[model samples]
Target: MNETLIRWLEEREIADVRSRNLELAKAFAMVVKSTDQVFDLGCGTMSNFRYLDPLLSMNQNWIGVDHDPGMLRRSEPLVPRTRVQLREMNLATGVRTLPQGPGCAFTASAFLDLVSKEWIDQFAAHCKDSPILIAMSTAGQPEWSPIHELDEPIRLRIKSHQNSDHGFGPSLGADAACYLVDQLRHYGCRVIVRETNWILDSRDGTLLSMMIDGIERRVQSVQDPVDAQVWADRRRLELLKAELRLTVRHLDLLSIP
Candidate 1:
């Protein structure tokens, strides 16, 4: 969530660039159906604008919110200042600053994995009174990876790797993915969920590298030097291995109610 982790996301997710983009596109397509307008939460670097650009070009209104001013500043040039409105907000803190009324929906890609259930429940409550849709939530956890066949050590290691990320939000928000499905339905959204699988073997090193580097940086901030070193060495080995098949199972929450 820090700039340091953001840098890691940028660096290591190179290989997953296409796949991740595709997933976002699929989510956007399902949500808005027609791109009249959208509200993007945690609009980091506003990079998501370009990914969903096909929708943007329809002259749809875009309102992006993020806590990082640096990301908002970087995203300003992508659209006419009028068409795109970027604000500073933290959804976990609250979305009272989010624009009111309906016909527009909320969206987030790979974002559910970063906030707590308290945030999700509060966000759902915000939309309960309107025809607002919580367009997309891509949670890449509780997945079935091809590496299921690998020895237990690596698998356990990968699980341990995920341990830190659990604190990020909903342990990838898989349960929230389910909870949102129900909540959105109650909000009158015609809700459904789609599971997406992305395979990461040795051949796809970009995201692997990013995950490793990001974890390393996070570990460095702690006081447990010995524990950090051990984690660092294991992740380094995984990073070098070209054939690590990590399957990403992500959920697409559809809200049409």
Candidate 2:
């Protein structure tokens, strides 16, 4: 992940707290027992661990896996090193390489949208016996409180960008969660999905700004440069005036096999 993107995720934790489905999290926690081991894929800076550790009562061991060594190194200070182990692994190859055992749970946050349908199927196949929680995937719906004429066009462009290959094959983007649910169920797992949207306003200015930048960048890649810049300028003006509020729709999925 980009460093700026990682920082944006860190900043957006507050919004995630408000948007995440607590009931689902509690349900997942109930399924976990003491001394269980949880593996977090694309763990990045370990924000998923930060959000879940307190909710789970088990004296569980956590393995944070990421392809980026820098991310793993950066997460060291934030996580309890004794109970949390950070490993370097490339999820792009497949999830089969992840450590496996009984009483293990698999998790990832804000990650599935970047993977392909094939990758998710492989993930389900490998973890057929483990309970899984995948959170905060983009749902291809973005709403601006004070609507802009360019909003829909921009959104479409961003969605297109989302589906672009991210090393694993064509990304499933917004369709990832639903695909995972179906694939996991095919593998005989029970799955539940819930919405987890980020509601951003002036109070979340930093994250809001970062989101605009990201959207604009994605749009630029797919549209004429001049048109993209104009759209971005209009959005940035609203952002500068503190006149914009954004709702970024995402989905969270839980699977028990």
Candidate 3:
């Protein structure tokens, strides 16, 4: 993966902290214990590690897995007091190789939405008996303040793009969290879900700008260039004037057997 993407993942952690559901984290923490092994899927640079390490029991072992060696290498320095072992693996197919059963937990942050339904089914079966916390899967279209007519059209384009293959075949995209919840329940796991929306304002200019740029890229192929540029420019102007507010809805899931 590119260094820029890794840096974005690191920076995004700040926003995610504010968005993460505390009650759901506490509930998941109650089931974990010292010395339990946790596998963090798609753990880019271990931002999830920093967020989860303190919440989990002391001395818990973590296996941070990602396909990118650069990200795993980047995660090395971020390790605080927890014992972390980084692994390079393609989670789309390698999830079945993860350990299961007692004294283990499964977790992933902002990952479920990128994977296909088949991959999720395999994941649900693998973690059926273990406690799992999957957080920050996008729930729906973002809410933008000072809404514009182009907002709806751009949003629809983004949705269409999200359903395309994201390295795991057809992505569940915005529907991932709900599908995972249903799948977990079918396996007899008690599941809890909470909103973890990213509410960005003027102070979040850099992150918000990056988000807008991403949206522009996603909509470029399907949306008219003139309309897309107009929308992007308007958003930039709003950010510059400190009048922009964006609420990106996400869901956090905690499942216990």
Candidate 4:
């Protein structure tokens, strides 16, 4: 993942309260019969563990995987050393190394959007017997409380950027949640999906600002750079004045074999 994206993930971990499907997560926890071994893919800073650990009733052993050694090191203090294990693995080429089987669960947060179809297929093949819970995959829609004229164009450009390769090949991006649901069902796994959109307002200014910057960067790469900058400026001003609110659509999925 890009360094900018890692920063954004840090901000998101703090601001992303709505994106966690607690009820579904609790349901997943209830089904665990033995030691809960959760393998969190792209586990930047172990934020997913921070969120789910409190909600789960059973004893958990988390194996957090990421290619970034810095991220692994940073997350070390967040989780108890006895309960958590960290692995430095690039998931794009390391799916074969993922742990699987009963008592194990696969999880990722705000991560599926960055992966390719082939990567997901390989992941599914490896974890065929494990339950999976994936959260916060983008759903390609941005709803602004006070609508702007440039919103649609900027959204289109961002969507285009999302579909571009992010090291795993052309990414499934916004369509990742639905695609995974279908793929898991084909494997005879029971799957459930829920909307987990991010609702941001004045109280979430920092995250809102980071979101605007990310959108502007993506938009600039594929569309008129000037327009993108101008739109970002206007949005930043609105954010500064506490006059902006945003609902970024996302999806969460739970699958059990």
RMSD of each: 4.8, 1.8, 1.6, 1.9
Q: Mind giving the per-residue lDDT tens digits that candidate 1 earns over 1-257? A: 36665664465335334455354455555555354567877877655565665643456777888777777776677666877899887665657656544666676655665555666667776765433323234444423232333234333444344433443344434455777666667777666566545556666666666655554554455444223445445555755755355556656555554
Model 4 residue runs over 4 Å out of place are: 1-6, 223-226
- Better-scoring candidate (TM-score), 3 or 4: 3
Candidate 3 per-residue lDDT over residues 1-257, each given as its tens digit? 59668767866888998899888887878898776898899998887778887877757888899998988777788785348899899988888888898989999998888988998889888888999999999889888998999999888888877777889989999999999999999999999999999999988888898888888876877645335778999999999999999999899999998
Q: In candidate 2, what are the lDDT values of residues 1-257, reduced to their tens digit?
A: 46886687688777887888888888888887767899999898898898888889849999999888988888899998889999998899957877554679988888999999889888888886887889898886689878877887777777777898988899999999998888989978889999888888887888877787777777776755325667667777888888888888899988877
TM-scores, all candidates, are 0.71, 0.93, 0.95, 0.93
Which candidate, 1 or 2, has the higher TM-score? Answer: 2
Q: Give the Cα lDDT of each candidate.
A: 0.56, 0.84, 0.87, 0.83
Clashes of each: 10, 0, 0, 0
Ranking by lDDT: 3, 2, 4, 1
lDDT of 3 at 125: 89
* Consecutive 10-residue window with the lowest summed lDDT within model 3: 218-227
Worst 10 residues of 4 by lDDT: 218-227
lDDT of 4 by residue, 1-257 (tens): 36776687788887555567887788777665547688899998988888877777647788999989988888888888898899999888988876678878888888999999998888878886888888888886788878888898877777778899998999999988898888888999998898888889999998888888878877767855437778888899999999999988888888888
